[model samples]
Target chain A: MNNYERYMGMVKGEQVDYVPRIPILMHYAAKHIGASYADFAGDYNTLVKANIALAEDFGVSQLDIMSDPWRETADYGAEIEYLETTCPQCLKHPLEDSKDLSLLTRPEVGKTTRLTAAIKAIEAYKAYGYKEYSITGWVEGPAAEASDIRGVSNFMIDLIDDEEFACELMDLCVDVAIEFAKAQIAAGADTIGVGDAIASQMSADMYERLVFPREKRLVDGIHEAGGLVRLHICGNTNHILPVAASLGVDIIDCDWMVDVVKVRELFPKNTVIAGNLDPVEGIMESTPEKIHQNFIDLYHKVGNPYFVNAGCEVPMDTPKENLQALCKPIQYNSSI
Target chain B: MMDLKDLTEAIKTGNRTQATSLTQEALDADLTPQSILDAMVVGMDEIGDKFKRNEVFVPEMLIAARAMNESMAILEPSLVKSGYKPLATAVIGTVQGDLHDIGKNLVSMMWKGSALNVIDLGTNVTPDKFVAAIKEHDAKLVGLSALLTTTMPSMKATVEAIKSEELSDVKILIGGAPVTQSFADQIGADGYSPDAASAVDSAHQLLGIR
Candidate 1:
């Protein structure tokens, strides 16, 4: 079966040929295609090409359109600098100095700066994808986009100093995310990965109070658009796993520090749990054999309804052999 | 109830307005800056320990740090006039090829709260710049941060570049999400810390400071 079918099959609890490898590959993909990270992030054509090339070479199942958090932030009139080798840098957060909500309006998906570029990526993937891969579109989750425009430190303080203003800002952000997620779905995305990485930094109570409802809104919005949801939060999320699971997204990614055994028990069997491997140690600095064995052991422990992923992105300079070892498929283990 | 303990509690709870006012009140009431600073440090110390135990998360630490900073704005001038010096001068930054700075910034704030006299070089800092800052400040410690695993090599490169300089008495402290103690040893970092509060302890341990 094709990778897309294999991915959905596992989520649907159908026995697939193997667990699909849906590791997030952006910087690594750019380097793989000999394109600068600027080329990969700024231009959708380049992003699509790099993802395709990465899948061809490394056998990652998902064709991901996530380059950076600045896609929507840039469209909101933030001055962003695209480095040759790394993601774009927002020179100034639009609301960093003034907590001005008036400075940002909803960006039209096709007319705005970088959001347009992402839509073009979804369209481009649809054009050439041939239903062979699971095309994953992305949006910064409510808190993440809020922090992106307000600066992380400022936003964190806002959460404490003014919960009301924080909710207002996140309300606007979640609206934007919902709109963006729908557009990507309309443009032919099978799944939308909502990256609420900033939420992981807050206390579980703060997250449940401020972020979970908005994140739930975004997830429901995506599902309403006939798309799947992958909630991607970076850093240790052992505190918020139950709240995260309650969102009922199609998938939840556990970083290396998250409790994998708890996650396996927390997520329903059909909700594909991806990751819990240290990207730096398990993949980057590891031998191919060790990497393979670790994944195999992880797969067995986490059981079925899993996607093979590192805790986060595959480091750009990971040994090709290590990636190959990770991608090397194991036969479907139905009984696990 | 106008005690320094209130200042400590204000800082710990991240009540910036209260922290600043209490700090000023302490100053007005003839509480020496050092005693005030010590009380404030206890609040940070408690928060840091809670952070390490996962009883508190980043927001608590952040607000606590912000509160400490707000109070420091009032307290710093007095400390200087009283002939105060920091524990040591330290240089810190997110390594080159990585621009994510929450971890680095938190560590910087923690270091500053501990009276380290930190010279923050900001994000995407190159190894040569680190070396230059170390030399310029005659810093006793260097803390390198990178959020992405991709930039861990940059950490290694910075460590190597600094080691090659043979700065006789400088220690390198490395951290971020993906960094491990083994990675620290492999990269030749003098020390490693997983969170911001412990970073102060690590810095003190590395430098043999109280």
Candidate 2:
């Protein structure tokens, strides 16, 4: 089977010819076309070109539509400073000095700056991509969006000193994420990747009380929009794996600290799982032979429903050969 | 209304009122500065244990930490004036290009309450800033933190930079949600802890303070 066919088969819970390769290539894309991160995140054409080039060069089964963490907050009027080598970050949160929820306006997905461009790019990709391949879009989860709006430290405090406000903020973020997910679906995305790296920091109680409901709401909304949901929490979610699995995510992207064997146990049989490789140790700093074995081991741990990816974004300077090693086994081994 | 044993239990269960009231009562009863500190450490230690076991979480830990810090404010000066010394001096900070400091700050607070002299370098610390702080404070150990995979390199780079400067003897400790012992060894960090409580254990072992 072709790469796209294999990926679709696995997602559909059918037997696949091989494990799907879906690297989280962001800066890798910019480097592919020799464009800077600043240009890649800020310009729609550059992003589309970079993502397309990466999918072709790497033979990845799915093409992702993700930028830096600042996209949603930027639409709400936060000041963002872009960089060449690093993902763009919020210079200052829009609500840094205030808790006036009334001042926060719900951003219209397709009309927001840069967001519209993302939708346009996804729509553009569907026109060009072959039928077998799937396009994945992206949105910031509520906890991450809270960090973008109120700053990380402040939000941690808000969780305690102001529970009501925290819930309000999360409610607003969920609404915005639902709207954003819908736009990406309308723009031709077959799946939506929810980036909620910050949510993993909270205690299970706080997470259940404050974060999980909103995430479930957002995930439900994306499903309603006719797109599959991939949840990327981006940390050692070992303690919360059961909670994450219970959310009914199509794929739970594990960070390196979470053991794949443990994740496989937490979720039901046939739940799709991806990642847990140390990006620095296994890819950026290790040899190709070592990296390939790591992938082989990961596949054995999680079996057929797994997608090949790092715990998070592929490092900017990861040796080309090291990353290329990730797909070597899948390309050669029929049942990987 | 506040009993010492109950305070320790309260902190473990994230009971702030009992923790605070007992802390004040401990002071009012003429309990030795050292004794109150001992009780606070006991409470924090249990909280840390629960954290490792996944019984308590960040928000509960935060409340327990805040209660400990507030009590420490009243107790720290007394301990100092009584010629008490922190078990060791340690410095902590989050690496460059990463602004997530909730984990780092929590670790630092736990260390401070556990009787270590902690110098916080705040977020987005460059190697130069770290090196300068190490030299200025004469800190024996360094703690590096990062929440982003993209910023993990900065932790590795800081370790290399510090070693390259011939300050290799300075024991470096690393932690955060994304960091693991394998990553710590690969980066040449002297120690790694998954949570704030373990950081105290790491600090003690690295310094031979225990």
Candidate 3:
């Protein structure tokens, strides 16, 4: 079966020839194409070329239209500082003053430069006719998007002191995410990845009250748009695994700090689980033999309907052999 | 009936207005500025411990810190008038090639609440800048942060640059989502902290303050 067919089959709980590997490669991909991260993030052609080249070279199962988290916030007029080899930084938050919330309105997806660039990247991947590979479009999850728009420290305070305002802001972020996801879907993205790294920093109670409902809406919206969802929250999410599982996204990524055995216990059997590897130790610093062994142990713990990837973005300096080990197909007993 | 204890409670619960009012009332009641400051410390200590126990998370710690900051703004003039001095000077920033700073900012705030003079160099700080700040401030402690594995090398570079400046007397502390004790030792750092609250303890430990 083709890579896309294998990935979709696994997501659908069908038997697959082998597990699919869809590691999130950002700076690594940029370096693969001999381009600076600033160039990769700023130009859609750079991002698409880098991703396509990396996919071809590394045999990764997917190509993602993801460069940085600041894209959505940048479109909202937040000040961002692009770097030579690192992800772009959001220097100024748009909603620093609560009064700015009233003045803020969602930008049209196709009109905004960054968002349109992402959609165009998806279209370019489709034009390349790599039907065997899954093309992913990404959006910030509600809580993360809110944190992006409002500064992280300010948004954290807002959650406690002004729940109503937090919800209002989150709703607006979710609306933007829905529109963005739909636009990418229309641009031929087969799946959408929702990154809510900030949600993992909250307590289970806080996530349930403030973050989960909006995330649920984003997930449901993406599903309705006829695209699968990959929910990635970077950090130990053990406290909110159940709440995350209940969102009904096709895949839930567990960071390195999360217990894989507990993830299997908390998530339903059919749910496709991806990642719990310590990106630094399990990928960047390890030898090929060590990486292969780590994945073997991880797969045993996480069980089937599992995709292979690092807990977070693969570090830019990761050895090519380590990645090769990661992409190496597992030999499984068909009986199981 | 609103005493210093009320001020502590206000800060702990993140009631900014109550914290401000309680601080003002404490001053009006002729309470020592040190005592009021101590009350804020007590509140931060409680939140810090709760954070260590996972009973509280980032938002709770942030709001509580905000409350403490708000109260400190009212109490600072009195403390300065009474000749209060910060414990020590600390220079902190996220290392170069790393833009994530929430953790660094939290540590900076915790140090400030604990009465340490913090010189925040902000994010994407290079090694030369770190050494320059250390030399300029004659800082007793330098805290380096990096949230990305890719940036860990930058942390190492900063640590080496600072150490190479013949500031062996100055302690270096490192922390972030991807940092670890082994990595700290590997990079020849003086200390490592996993989170912001413990970062205060680590800072004190590094300086032989407590």
Candidate number achieving the greatest TM-score relative to the actual structure: 1
TM-scores, each model vs. reference: 0.97, 0.89, 0.96
Residues forming the 10-long window of minimal summed lDDT in candidate 3 chain A: A327-336
Pitting candidate 1 against candidate 3, the one with the higher DockQ is: 1
Task: Give the alpha carbon lDDT tens digit for every residue of A124-210 in model 3.
Answer: 999884577998999999999999898888888889878898999999999999999999999999899999999988999999988
What interface RMSD do all candidates show, one decimal each?
1.2, 2.1, 1.3
* Candidate 1 per-residue lDDT over residues A58-125, each given as its tens digit: 78888889998898998877888999988789999888898879978567786897888888888888
- Which parts of model 2 have CA positions greater than 4 angstroms off? A1-3, A14-17, A96-98, A130-132, A153-164, A203-210, A261-270, A329-336, B1-32, B74-87
Q: State residue A204's C-alpha deviation in candidate 3, in Å.
A: 0.8
- Go through the candidates in order and give the clash count of each: 0, 0, 0
lDDT tens per residue, model 2, A1-336: 876677777878787667787888887788889998899899878888888887777777777778788888888888899987767877889899899977765677556786787788888788878455778889999988988899886787788879899889989999888988898988888889999887777776677767888899998999999988999988777766667777778888988878888888888766778886888777788899988888887787677688888877778778889878876646324353
User: What is the C-alpha local distance difference test score of each model?
Assistant: 0.88, 0.82, 0.88
- TM-score between candidate 1 and the true structure: 0.97
Error of 2 at A204 (Å): 4.4
Q: If ranked by DockQ, best first, what sequence of candidates would result?
A: 1, 3, 2
Query: What TM-score would candidate 3 get against the native?
Result: 0.96
> Better model by TM-score, 1 or 2?
1
Q: lDDT for model 1, on a 0 to 1 scale?
A: 0.88
Question: What lDDT score is found at residue B140 in candidate 1?
Answer: 96
